[model samples]
Target: MQFNPVTFAIPVFVALIVAELLWARRRQPRAYESRDTATSLAIGLGSTVAGGLTAAAVLAMLVWAHSATPLSIGWAWWAWPLCFVLDDLAYYTFHRSAHRVRWFWASHVNHHSSQHYNLSTALRQSWTGFFAASFIFRLPLAFAGFEPGMILACGGFNLIYQFWIHTESIKRMPHWFEAVMNTPSHHRVHHAVNARYLDRNYAGTFIIWDKLFGTFAAEDDADQIRYGIVHQIGSFNPLKVVFHEWLAIARDVWRAPWRHKLSYLWREPGWSHDGSRETSDMIRRRWNAAATDQKD
Candidate 1:
């Protein structure tokens, strides 16, 4: 309930953007990123404003209806802590679903479309991603008696905390810290294009969630990661960026055999028996490989 949409999200969001541009300039003042900054910013800014207003309206109405005559909005206060756990758990489900569901991946892939992994690239968020995974995970909050306010606070906190881990500046952490939380090291692997690094380290806050769920992959300093997706999305148009994947999914689904409908939702991205194996099975065969193997 303490989460004000603007107060919680805007500050960190602004700070991250400012920091990224500063870091990029300091690293090399003349090196302009090939990606379109103006278009990316437009998409990011537009999505944030539209999504925030729509989400706020939905939540406000939901909370009001639940807080009828006898109850007050403050009733949501008691559920704040549970909101954190529920939101994180829901986020895990949300992420996992985004990967498993082909239709959803189209909306979700915008985050991975860039060939370079930088702060500006992080802002290349999808404009229409939530539609793919929002339904299944959000209903639990309502069922658990969490008014809209509490749910919003928990969701906002997870997102705000995750912003800083998107960079390449920070490297490995001290033993215990890396064990429990998501660091740049872990997130780097998540953004990696090398087959071994794809789709791992999906945690938002506590890296332990990935550890417990068996999705964590330690950084490998030896084989430097190549950032971006297999087929880079070439356009800078925000409209194209948002809907491109959805279009791919529709084409794929139309061409897919009827028996494979369910499998389409579970198969790995870019997977088609008709295609190539980008990452060999042996590369990701183990989870806790020695640090020596991880040196990139």
Candidate 2:
């Protein structure tokens, strides 16, 4: 029998909950001003647990379906290390696509909802992920002759590696290790909303994917990172978290042309007007400028 992820992963779950509680206690003063941070977290966590377990059940079915046959296409259990890398390649594609599509981004936007970045924030995964991230793309792996169990296991493996990097500690890895794999340093950049840090470094285990694909960006010490999106939802409410961007998407779709409507679902999140009106950067700045001008 293979190692059960729920069994092995218990330590991670327990540790995160304990650590986040301690962190919450320490930051109670700041959290009050942030207004109901605990409430948002409670709802968000419930949704995340429900959503994650639901997804796991769905993934398990695929694994069981392809496990018995002599027709498994992926490498053997011994060769799963390579399959891990392949799994990450597909992950990168799914991630990039998720950001590109508004509907997909709606489910994913929750992970980035927090203005604060920490382990708990990482666990603040969206519940509606099933609607956006189906097993459609990964099915290709099954068809390519790879065993579903191997592929699904690799998916879990990728997610496990990705979890610890959600910390503020462990700033960097060794020079050699940092050169190849995704370190916390790279992940910190991914969480930043700073103009330069918006969408860089999407690799799970290998930084090589980002380097090869031109999405890599080195972290800077001089400029402190401001975490979260340009437009902060400022709530831990799971319903709001999952539907906030979706609401924005619906508004954009209402007035948009047929071509624009379709593109909003298929193109990048900030894509607008055939590159005519404004960039996401420009829109954020303009909104801020207008707010400032009103204040003055």
Candidate 3:
């Protein structure tokens, strides 16, 4: 069994979620809804079971890639920090693609399915992430000579860093920290379904990547954040939450012309051959145009 920091952090995760629940009840009674939290936790448990079943095969591929590469970067003191930065970049790339590509979004949409932003929302992971092959983004680090174990450690730590940022509790950090780190405020924008925030802030641990890529969007106080996908799901069933988008994709692809079948799978979410739907970029542009007209 590999040493997974996220596995060890499970107890800590539970403790914080309980503490948050107590705090929410006293401070904001509506912050934690019974059905919503249960749904998030259920989806999270399903993700864990799915991850466990697929971990061995994922690890095998990483090990094979590392062995085939001639570069042998050992675990030196500096190597750890280097791996962390590199892995964070990998995460940003994979996370951005997951939002843009329909095939990947089918697995990722569940995480944003929750309307309430709280600690438990962080655990609402994807049940089909292993099959999505997003982990292929990290293979480059292995081939670059970073040890497989080291890469995994950095990846785990990256995930742990993101867990605390899923809350609505901490409004914002100091300007300096908020400028670099992926704080709760930035993450709120990422989870938002609001037009201006739809496809922005795709960072995992560091906000720098989003800033550099022009994808960062600060949370706006004037326009409050609305979490979840653009088209919300009504069901709290774990199976429904995890696979709804995928089922939708299957139906859409099945009905499309053969020439357009691949487009249905690879195009952005909300894409349509008949121009009836809108992608994130299209949504944001329309919002921006409306704002401009108002200003004019």
lDDT by residue for model 2 over 1-296, one digit each (tens)?
43435446647765874675576567642322233345445645666476567766656656755564456655656658767878888888777666556667777777777776555565665677666655555766665567666777788778777777766656788999888998889888988887667677888889889999988988999868887776778666667876788788788789798867877666667777667644455665776788789999
User: Model 3: per-residue lDDT, tens digit, 1-296?
Assistant: 68789999999999999999999999988789999999999988999999889888888889999999999999899999999999999999999999999999999999999989999999999889888887799999999999988999899999999999999999989999999999999999999999999999999999999999999999999999998899899888989999998899999999998989999889999999989999998999999999999999
Residue 295, model 1, lDDT? 78
Query: Which runs of model 3 end up more than 4 angstroms from their true locations?
Result: none
Model 3: lDDT of residue 36: 97
- TM-scores of the candidates are 0.79, 0.79, 0.99
For model 1, the local distance difference test gives 0.67
Candidate order, lDDT descending:
3, 2, 1
The candidate, 1 or 2, that scores higher on TM-score is 2
Q: 157, model 3: CA deviation in Å?
A: 0.8
Q: Give the TM-score of candidate 2.
A: 0.79
Best by TM-score: 3
Model 2, stretches more than 4 Å misplaced? 1-8, 20-44, 47-49, 52-57, 60-71, 274-296
lDDT of 1 by residue, 204-272 (tens): 777878888888788888879887666777787778777786786677678878886555556666665
For all candidates in order, the CA lDDT equals 0.67, 0.70, 0.93
